[model samples]
Target chain A: MRIFDPHIHMTSRTTDDYEAMHAAGVRAVVEPSFWLGQPRTSPQSFTDYFDALLGWEPFRAAQYGIAHHCTLALNPKEANDPRCTPVLAELPRYLLKDQVVAVGEIGYDSMTPAEDAALEAQLQLAADHGLPALVHTPHRDKLQGLRRTVQMVRACALDPERVLLDHLNETTVREAKDSGAWLGFSVYPDTKMDEARMVEVLRAYGPEKVLVNSAADWGRSDPLKTAKVGEAMLRSGFGEDDVDLVLWRNPVAFYAQSGRLRLDTPAAGATFEGNSILRGTPGAPDVPAPVGS
Target chain B: MTTVPARHDTPADTGAPGLPPGLDGPARAWLADALTEAARAAQAEADPGGTWQIRFAEAGRRCGPGHADAARVELLAAARPGVADLTALYRQGTAAERRAVLLALGRLEPAAAEGLALVEDALRTNDTSLVAAALGPYAAAHLPAHAWRHGVLKCLFTGVPVAAVAGLSARARGDGELGRMLRAYAAERTAAGRPVPHDLTRVLALTEEP
Candidate 1:
C-alpha cells in the first residue's frame, strides 16, 4: 500500500499526522507551493515560505522517516494581485534550487488578464528551468480553464507531458488527458471528488497519466484522502498493484519528470553536524550546580 | 509509578575521581557554578522579557567545541539526576526543552506529570516555531488532541520546512502507541485539507506484510 501523494502541504500538518501517514503506508509526497490563507504581502514572505518548503519541512519529515519533495509556483489566485509582481520576480531564484520539482499550482483561477500574463510568465520560467508545471484549474468554469491551460501550455511551447493539471473534475480530466498533460484529482471532504469517485476515476482511467492527491492545506480538505482512495480501490476488488499505481507510482512517475524530485529515506542514528542547518540555538538549558559549588 | 528505563544506557567513563581528567579544580568549579547560575537565570528569564539573550550567549560561549569534556561532565551529572541539562544549555529554550526536561523527569519518577502539564500549557504561545518544536517531539509519545495534530499538520504542509517535520516525526517515532495514534490523527487531519508530515509518508511506503 505504498503511495506517493503528489500534491500535499506539509506546512499545515503536525508531526502526529506524519506518523499517521507513515502508518498508512505513504512513502513519499510532493508539496506544491500555493496561496497561504491570505495573500503574501511581500517577496520576503514568499522567500521564507520557499525556504521552509525546501529546508525545514524536509528535516521535519526525516524525523518521521518519510521522503519529502516539493514544487515551486506562484499560485494563480494571487497572480492577479498587484503586490504579486515583486514576488513573481523573486521566484526564479527559488526555481533554481535543487528541491524545486516543478513550477506549479500555477494556472487559472478567474482567468483574468493579469492571471493570464502571470501564468504565461511562470510557464516560461518552468520551460526555461527545465521543470514541470503543476497547473491549477479553476473551480468555476473548469472546462474553459482547462482549455485555456492547454492553449497556454502549447503557446508557451512547454512540453505537454511536463504539465500537471490539478483539481480536475470529470469534465476536465478527459481534456487534460487528451492534451497529453498529467491529470491530478484532489479528493476533497465534500467540494471536490470524494474517495469513491476517485476510485471510479481510477477504474475508468486505469492509472496512466493520472495521480490522486488530497491537495490538503489550511482550507477544508483531507490529508489522507489519497489513502482513502486506495481503500476504495481495494474495496472495488482492484489489486494492491492497481492501488499502488494510482496512489503511489503514478504521482511519483509524473513528478519525476521534473528531474528535481528525489525520494529521500531517513538515516538511522544520524547525528547533526556542528555547522549543520539543525545546529542552531533556540533556547537555553538548565544545569544543576556541583554539590559544593 | 511506572519506571521507564533510561533512553540511553551507555556507561560513563569517569577519567579520575577527584580531578576530572581535562579540567583543573578551579575550572571545574567555575564550569559547575556557571552552569548552575545559567540554569537559574534561564528559569528566571522564562518570561518573554527575561534576560534570555544574555543567558544564551553566555551558555554558547561556555559550550565551545573545546568544552567537550565539560559537555561530558554535564551529561554525566544529568544522567545521575535523569534530567536533560544538555538540551537546556541552548538558551531561551522553548517548550521542546521543557518537554525534554519533563521526559527526563518522567524517566526519573512518574509524578513528573505536573511538570509535563506546565510545559504542555506553554505550547499555547503565539510563536509557531516554538510551539511546533516543543510539541512536535512529544506528540507521538503523548498523542494529544486532533486539533494539536491539526496545527502541526498545517505547519508542515502549507509551507513549513521539511526539517521541522523531520524533527517532530523523530520524536513521535519513539513511541509505537503514539505512532499509531498519529496515523489516525493524520487521516483525520489530511481529510480536513492538511498535509501529512513526511514521516507518515515513509510509513505509507512500507510494503504491507502478506
Candidate 2:
C-alpha cells in the first residue's frame, strides 16, 4: 500500500513521525499552510513558515524517502487577521513554485466576511496559477459552512472539479458530492471522522472523487488515520483496488493537477543552509583525544 | 499489503538491456488497449491528475513517459471506457499528458508517429522535466542513438539527474562516443569554472564497458 496522505500537517510533526509514516505505507504528504493553533501576529511569520515548507521540511521528509509537497493559503481563521492578510499578496510567487500543489486549507473557519473575501481572492489565485484548492469547512457551523462554501465555490471562476471541500462528514458529504467538487474527510483522534466512519462514507459514497486524510496537525490527531481507514475499508468488504483508489490514487490525482508531482523520485539528502540532519559537524574535533587522555 | 499483480517475467518486462521491443508484442497490445480506453475517458488533460485520469491512475499508470516497469504495466487494464478519440488529446494536451500518451504508444506504428513526434518536441524543450521525461521508457526503446546521447547531455546541461534517463545503464555502457562527448562537456564546464554537474561523474562512470 503506497499511501499518499493528501493532507497531513507534517510541519507540526517530527522526524520520527515521518519514519513511522513511511513504515506504515505513507509514501508522500501535502502539508497545507493553516492556522497554527495560535494566531500569528504578522505575515513575516508566514513567509518563514512557507520557506520551511519548501525547504527544511522537504529535506527532512527526503531523509526517509517520503515526497513532501504543500498547499499555500492565508487560511480561513487567519484571513480575519489584518496582520496576516499581507500573505495574500505574497502568494503568487510561492504558488508558482513546483512543490505547491494547491491553494488550500482555505475556507470558513468562522465563516466571517473577511474569510469570504480571502477565499474569493485565493480562489482566483488558484485559477490564475492553475492549481486545485483544498478547502476547510467551518467546524463550528459545518453544514452552513459547507453550504456557503459550495455556493461561493460554484460562483467563482475556478472549476468545481478542481476544488476539494475538505474536513467533510455525514452532514456535508451529500452537498459536496452534488457540487461537482472533490470530497475530503479528515480522520482524527477525537473531533473529525474516525476510521470506521470513514469506511462508512466510502461505502455510501462509492469513493469516486473522495480523498481521505489524517489532518494530523499540532492537535491531538493520529497520523496513521489514513492507513487505518484503508484497513477498515478492507475489513468492511472493500477490494484492495478500491482501497488503493481512495487512499493512494485519489490524492495523486488531486495534486497531480499541479503537473509538478513526481512521486516516483526518491528524495534523499542531508544538509541545508549550513545545517545538517546528519550526525557529525564538519571539521569538528573528535570527542575523545586518546593521546591527551 | 494490497495484492499487486506480480510483474510479467517475460523478456520485455525486464527492460534489462533496452526498452521492450515495441514491435508487435504484449507491450504494444497493452499500449493500444490503454490508448483506445484513454481516448474515450482517460484524463488526457493538460494536467496529469484529474477525475478522468483516475482511470489511468486506477490502471495504476502514472503520468510519465510510460515505463514497462512492473507497477506501471499492471494497471494496463481497468473499468475504463474508449480510446479512439485521442487525436485531439495527443495534439492538444500538456507536455505531461503528451508524455503519458507517448508512453502508452509503445512501438505501435502510425500511432507511433504521433508519440515519437511528441518525444521529439519534448527533446527540443528547455523545460528540464519535459526534456527528462522525453527520455522516459518509451523514448528509451525508440529514440535513435544520436538523439539519445544528445538527450543525455541535455540532462547534464539542465541539471536533471541522469537517473531520470530510464535506460542509463544499457544506453551508457560501452558507448565510447558518449564517453567522449561527456568528457569534452565536463572539460568545458571546468575551464569556465562552472561546477560540472554531479551526475556527469555517474554517467561518465557508466560509460565504462564493465
Candidate 3:
C-alpha cells in the first residue's frame, strides 16, 4: 500500500529510516518545521534547518526512492525569543521555494501574547501568499489554544479547510472539526494516542476530515507510527481505499491547496542544476566551467 | 573474469608532462581495464558490500570530478596499495552530495582504507563538530592504521598533496614496504611542527606509536 506520512520530522532520523520506509511502501513524507531538541541562538540555525528539510533530507530520501516534502515556519516554541524576528523575515524566501508545501507547524503555545503575535504574523504571511497553514496546538491548555487558533484564522478570513489544527485528542478534535478545519492526530509512543486508541478515535470520528501522523521528532516518537495506524485501520475493517484516503489522499489534497507541492518526475539522466538545494548555495550559479574553462 | 579490451585513444593531456618514461603499454592497458571494470561495478552496486571494490577501481582510473570517469594517468599515483581516493572525492564534493556518497561508501567498504581516508580528511578540517562527523564513519569502518602521513610530493614539481598520496598509502596499510614508508613519513611530519596536510589527524590519532 502506497502511504504518505503527512507530518514526520525526518531530520532527527537516519538513512535507515529512509530504507525502512521505502521497504514498507512509504512513497513520500511531509516534514513540518518544529522546535529542535534545543533552542537555536540565531537565524542561521533556521536557515540551516530549512536547508536540511528541503535539501539533504530529500537527497537522503531519494537514495531509497522516497520523496520528501516540507512545511516552512517559525515554530511556536521558538517564537517568544527576541532572536526569532530575523528568522521570521527569512521565511518568505523559503516559502517561495517549490518544495515548501505549507506555512506551519505554526500556532499558539501557552496562549502567550508572543505566541499570538507570531501566529498572527505567520497567518498574515500565509494569507498574503495564499498558502495553507499547519497549526500546532499547545500541549498544556490545548483546548484554549485550539479555540484561539480557530478564532484567529477566522479573523484573518482564512478558509477553514486550509488550516490543519494538529496534535488533537478527544478534547480538541470536535472543536477543530466543528470549525471546518482539518483535524490532525499525532500518534506518540506514550503520551499521545497509541495504535489501538487511535483506532477507537477513527471509529468515533468516521475518518472524515481526519489525518494521522507520527510527529516523530527528537522525542520518544516512532517514525513508523503512521504505518502502524494504517495497519490498525485495516485491522479495524477500514477498506484499503479508506486507509489511503486518510494517510495519503487527504494530506496531498489539503497541502496541495498551498500551490507549492510539486510532483515533477526528475528527468532520467538529468544532471543536478548546480544550485541543487541539496548541494550548492541556494542562489549560486552552477559550477562555472571550473572557474574559466 | 572476462577481461574487456582497453579503449585506446591519444593519452589525454592531464596537465602532467609526458607519460613516465619506460612505462609498459600492455601493463597500463591491463590496469586501465581492471579499473574500468571496478568503476562500472561501483556505479551498478549502490549497496554497502561493493563500495571498496568500486573505490579501488575508481582510484585506479583516476577520473576527474565524478568517480565514474575513465581512468586518467594521475589516478595511478593514488592506486598504490594504501591509497584512499574515496576520501579525496568526499573532500572535493559539496557537503550534502559528499554525505550521500560517503554514506554509501561507508556501508559498502566500512573496513576498507577508502572509509579511513574519508574520515581522516573530515578530522583534518580542525573543526571539532566536523571531526566527529568524519570519525563516525571511520569508527564504523573499524580499520585502524598505526600512523598516516598527509603531504609528500609524488612527482617533481607536481607536489600532489598528502590527501592524494594517502589514498594510495591507505591501500597498503598492512604491507611491510608501504608500512615503512608510511612510518618514516609520519616521523618527518612529527619532527616538524605541522601536521600532515589534507587532514591526517584521524589517521594519526589511531596510532599507538610516536
Candidate 4:
C-alpha cells in the first residue's frame, strides 16, 4: 500500500507526523509553498521559506523514510502583498532546483488584479521551467473560483494538461475535469472531503488524472488521509490497481513531467544537517519507573 | 534503574569532528569528492565563496545527513575559512549549517577563541541540538567559567543531557558555585512539584566531587 500525498506542508508538521505517515506507507510527498499562518513582512521571508522547503524540510522527511519534494511560488494569498511580489522574480532560480517538481499553490485567493498577475506570472514560469503548476482555487466561491482559474489556464501559456486545480469539491469537480487539467481533492479530518466522500468522487469521476492529498498544514488536518482514502477505496470494492492509480501513480505521472519527482528515501539513520530526529538515545530513555513501584 | 552514559572531556567523538567514522563506501567517496572541490576552491588565489557554500549546503543531500557534519567540517577545514567567513556562515546559514560551523570550530582553530560568539549564540537558543553542539570542545575550552556554568544549567533546563556538555567532570568538580546553582534548581523544581531531572542529580554529584 505505497502512498504519495501530492500536497502536504511538512514544514508546518512534526517528526511524530512523519513517523505515522511513513508507517501508513506514505513513501513520497510534494509540499506546495503556502503562506505562513501570519503574513510575511518581506520577500526575503519567502526565500527563506523556499530554502527550508528545498533543504531542511526534505532532510527532515528523509530522516523518517519519506522522500520530500516541494513546489515553489509566491502563493495566491501573498500575491496581493507588494512585499511578497518580489518573490515572483526569485521563482525562476528556485524552479531550477532538482527537488522542485512544480511551481504551485499559485492561483486565486481574492481574484485581485495582483493575484491575477502573480498567478499568470507563475503559470508562465512553470511553462518556462517545463514544470507542472499546482493551482489552489479559492475556498470561498467554489464554482466561480474554479471557473476563473480554468479561464486563466485557458488564457495562459501553460497548457491545461500541465495544471492541477486543487481544493476542489463536488460543485467544482465537473468543471475542473472539463478544463483538461489534473483534478486535486483535499480530504481533511472534518471540513473538506473525507475518506467516504473521496471514494465517492473516485467512483463518479473514475480516477484518471485525479490526485488526492491531505493538504495538511498548520491548520487542523490529517496527513494520513491518502492512506484512509485508499482503505475506503478498497472497502468500496475498487481493485488494488484502482487504488494505486489514484493514490500513487497519478501523482508520480503528473510531477514526473518535471523530470524531478525523486522517490528514493535515504538510508536509515541518516541525520539532517547536524540534527537527527533522535532524543535521549535511539532505543533507550532512562524512564524512572512508576515512582516507588 | 538509571543509566549513566559514558563521559568524554575531549572533542574527538563529542563534537562530531573529522569524517564521521563508519561512513559506508559511497558516502565516504561523496565526501572525498566534496572535500576535493572545497580544497581546490580554497587553493585558488581568489576563493569562489559561492562554490564552497553550495557544496556545504548540498552535503546533506549528497553525503546523507549522518555524515553531513563530517563533510561540512572537512569543507571548512579544507577551505580554511577565517573568522569573518565562519561568522557569515553562522549568521546566514540555517540552524543546521550554524551547528556544523560550531562543531567545526574545535578543529578549525583548536586554541583560538575566535568562534566564541557563535558558541554563545547557539547556547542562548533552546534548540537542544544547537545547545548540545554549542557545548562542544570549543565552548568547553574557551567559554568563561561563569558562562560555562550557565550553559550546563541550560542543558539541564532544556533536558539536554549533561553528558553532551564536553569536559563536564573536570569543570563541575570542586565548583562550589555550580553546586549552589544545582541545589537551587533542584529546590525550585521540588517547590513546584516537578520531578527533578535524573541529570540534575548526576551533575549535582559531579559538583560535589573534590
Candidate 5:
C-alpha cells in the first residue's frame, strides 16, 4: 500500500497534512515549486521559497516519515512578470542541488511569449542539469495548451521521454500519450480529473508512463488523492501490480532519470528543518503557571 | 487502447562510506560519494553556500537512516577541515547542511568554541532540526549544563521528539535545573490546555528516579 505522489505542494501545507498523508500510505512526495495564491514581486522571494523547499520542506516531510523532493523553476505565472524574470537566472544554482529532480511547473499560464521563453530556457536547464522536465499545461484552453506544449517539448534537445506533461485531462491524454512523453494528471475537487474519472483513464490508457498527482496546494485539494485513486483502481478490478505502476513505479522511473529519486528515507525526526509543528499558547490571563511552578 | 510497457526501477539502498558494519556495497559506494561530495563542498570555498551540503543530502537521501547518520560523520572525515572552516560552512549552510555540521562537530579537533556558538545559534531558532542537532553528542560534551538543560527543554517546547537528543538519558539523569524547567514547561502547557509533550513525563520520571 506504499504510495509516491509525484506532484504536490507541501510548502503551502501544514505539518498535520504530512501526518495525514503518511498515515494514508503516502511514503514520498515531489513538491514542484508552483505559484502561491498571491503573486511574488521579485526573484528574491522565490529564492527564499526555494530555500525552504529544498531545505526546510524536506525536513518537514521527513518528520512525518515522508520523503520530500522538489522541482525548481520560474513558474509559468511568474515568468510573465517582467520583474520576476530574474528567477530564470537564479534557477541555475538551484537546479544544481540534488533534491531538485526536475525543472518544472513550466509551460504556460496564459501562453505568453514570456512563458515560452521560460519553458524553453528551463528545458535547456533540465538538459544541462541532467534532470527531467515537468511541464504544466495551461488550465485555460487546455487542449490547445497540451498540443502546443507537446510540440514545444519535442523541439527541445531533451528526449521526449524526459518530459512530463502534467495537469492533463481526457481531451489531451491521448495526444500526450502519442507524443512519446510521460503523461500526468492532477485529480482535484472541482477541476481536472477525479477518482472515478482517473480510473476510467487507467482502463482506457493502461498506465504506461502515466503519473497521477493531487496537485494539492494553496487550493481546494486532498493530499490523499493518490491513495484514493489506488483504492478506486482496486475497487475497479485493477491488480495490485497495475496500481503500483501508476501510483509508485512510474514516478520513480521518471525522477530516477535525474539519478536523484531515492524514496526510502523514513521521515526522520518529529521536527522540520529543526522546527516542530507544536507551539505553546500564550495564556489568556496570567494564571501564574499551573501552580507546580 | 494502446499500451507501451515502461520499466520502473525500484530504487535500491546503497551503503555510505564510513558507515557502521554490515551494510551492502552499493550503500558504501553511495555514502562514499556523499562524504566525498560534502568534503568537496566544505573545501570548495571559504563559503560554497548551500550547494555542497545540498548535494551531500541528495546522496544521503539515497541510503538508509543509519547510514545517513554515518554520512555526516564521514563528511568531516572526508573534509578534514578546521573547526573555523566547518563553522563557516554551518553559518552559510541551509538547515540540512547545518545539521550535518552539527553532527560532525564532536569529531572535529580542538572542539572549537566557534562550534559551540553555532550550536547556541541553532538552539535559538524555532527550527526543530537545528535544536535537535544542537543537542547531539558535541553539545552534551561541550555546552554548559545550564544551556544544555535548556536545550533539552527546547526540544520539549518545540515538540521535537526527545529521542533526537544524542545523549539524553545520561545527560538528563540528575540535572536539577532541567527538572525544574520541565515541570514549569509542563505546567504551562497544561494551563494552556496543551497536550504537554508526551516525552516530558518520561524525562521528568528519569530525573526523579535518582
Candidate 6:
C-alpha cells in the first residue's frame, strides 16, 4: 500500500520513524507547523521552524525515499500567546514558499477570542494564497468545538471544501461530515481514534474525502498508526481501493489543491551507505578517515 | 503493498520522444478534448484566466500520472501560451505542471533566452524530475555554458540519470571546466566513504575529448 500521511509531525520524529514509515508503505507526509509542547517566545522561532520543514526535514526524508511537505500556521493554542501572535503576520511570506501545502492546524484550541481572530485571519490567508487548511479542533469540548468550527468555516471567506477538520471522534463525526469539508482522523496510542475504531469510522462513513493520519509528535503517539489503520480496514472487509483512497489519494487530492505537493522521491540512487544522517562534512578530519582495503 | 497497475512496457513508455503514442485510447480521447479547450482558450485572449490553468492542472488525474507529462506537453502546444502565461502557470502550478512547462520550452519557439529563468529556477530545486526537465533541449540550445555545467553536476548529486539530460554529449564534449567539476565531486564522494555516481564518470569521459 502506498501511504500518504496527511498530517504527521515529522519535525519531532526521529530518523528511525521515517525508516519504519517507509517500510510500512508511507511514501509521503505533510508536517503541519504546530505549537511545541512548550511555548515559543517569538515569531523568529516560527520562521526557523518553517525553514527546517521546507529545507532540512525534506532533505532528511529524501535519504529514506520519502517525500516531505509542510503546512504553515500560528497553531490554535499559540494564537492565544502574545509572543507568538506575530507569527500570524509572518505566515503570509512562508505560505508563498513551494513546500507549504496549506495554512493549517488553525482552528479552536480553547475557542478564546484571540483564537477566533487568528483562525479568521489565517482562513483569509489560505484564501488569498489559494491553499487548503488543516484545522485542529478543540479537544476539551469536543461537540461544541466541532460546532463552532463548522460555523466559523461557513461564515469565513474560505470554502469548507478547502478545510480539513482533524482529530475527530464519534461524537463529532456526523456534524463534520455534514459540513461539506474533508474528514480527518488522527489515530494515536491513547487519546484520539485507534486503528479498530478508525476502521469502524470508515465503515460508517464511506472513505470519500476522509484522510487518516498518525498525528505523531514528541508525545507518546505512534507514527505507525496510519499503517495500522490501513491493515485494520483491510481486515474489516474493505477492499484495496478503499484503503488507497483513505490512506493515499485523498490526502494527495486535498493538498494538491495547493499545487505544491512533490510526490516524486528526489534521492533515487543517492543513499550514502544506508546512513540517512551522515552527509559527510567536507574537510572535517576528525570524521572517519577513508580506509582503503 | 497495494498493487499499482504496472506502466505499459511498450517501447514508447521508455523514452520521452515517443510518449504520446504510449497513452491508451481513453487518455487519448481525454487529451483531444483538453487540447480543443486549450486552443479555444488561447484564441480568446493572452490571458485565458483560471479555467485554463485548472484544466492544465487536471491532466494528471484525467490521464494517468505516467502519461500526464505527455498530455501536458500536448496541451502547451495547442494553447500556444506565451512567456507570461507560462510563467504564471509555472509559478502557481504544482511540481508536475512546472515540469511540463520546462519540457515544452524547447518546442515553444521561444525568443532568445525567453524561458531561461524558468529553467534556472527548476535547476535550483532538489526535485530530480524538475532538474531533468529543466535540462531538456531548451537548456541545451540556450542556457549559458556556466549554468549548464552546474546543471550537469546537479544531476550527479541528485541521482537523476544523466541520460535524461538532452544534448549531453554535445554540451559536455570538450568542456574542460565540467571535467574539473566532475573530478572534484567524485573526490568529495570518495573522501566521504560514499560511492561516486557512475553517471559522473560517464559525463567526465565526455568532457575529456578536448
Residue A249 displacement in candidate 1 (angstroms):
1.6
Query: Which portions of model 5 show Cα errors greater than 4 Å?
Result: A266-274, A280-293, B1-210
lDDT tens digits, residue span A1-293, model 2: 76889998888997678777877888888999987764466889999999999998887787667888999999886786666799898999999988999999899864557888999999999999999999998654456678999999988989898999998888778889999998999998765687877877788889999999999988789888889999898899999999899998988998998787877534354477867665575534221111112
lDDT of 6 by residue, A95-169 (tens): 999989999989986466888899999998999999999999865445666899898999988888899999887
Candidate 3, residues B8-66, lDDT tens digits: the string is: 33343333231322233443444456545444444552424544444434432332233
Model 1 vs truth, CA RMSD: 19.5
Model 3, span A53-133: residue lDDT tens: 887777656545666789889888677666665788899888888888889889975455777888999988887778889
Candidate 3's docking class is incorrect
> What DockQ does model 6 achieve?
0.01
Model 4 lDDT per residue over B81-170, tens place: 778778888877877888899988888874455587678667656578888999988887888886688788878877799889889998
Candidate 5 C-alpha lDDT tens digits along A219-276? 7899899999999999999999998999999999999999988776643554564455
Kindly give the stretch of ten consecutive residues in candidate 1 chain B with the minimal lDDT sum.
B1-10
Checking candidate 4 for backbone clashes, the offending pairs are A271-B66
What TM-score should be assigned to candidate 4?
0.56
- Each candidate: what lDDT? 0.63, 0.73, 0.62, 0.80, 0.77, 0.81
Question: Can you give the TM-score per candidate against the true fold?
Answer: 0.55, 0.56, 0.54, 0.56, 0.56, 0.55
What clash pairs does model 2 have?
Answer: B36-B82, B36-B83, B39-B83, B40-B82, B59-B75, B66-B103
Task: State the displacement of the C-alpha of residue A33, model 1, in Å, after optimal TM-score superposition.
Answer: 0.9
Q: Model 1 over residues B83-121: C-alpha lDDT tens digits?
A: 233333322344334333433332333233433333333
Q: Which model scores highest in lDDT?
A: 6
lDDT (Cα, tens digit) per residue for candidate 6, span B1-210: 323334453233323332377765555555667787888877876553656567689888766798889888888887888887888788777899989999999888566455986787677566789999999998999988877876887787667999999999999999987887677666545533457788998999999986
iRMS values in order, in angstroms? Answer: 13.2, 27.2, 27.4, 21.8, 22.1, 23.1
Which of 1 and 2 is the better model by TM-score? 2
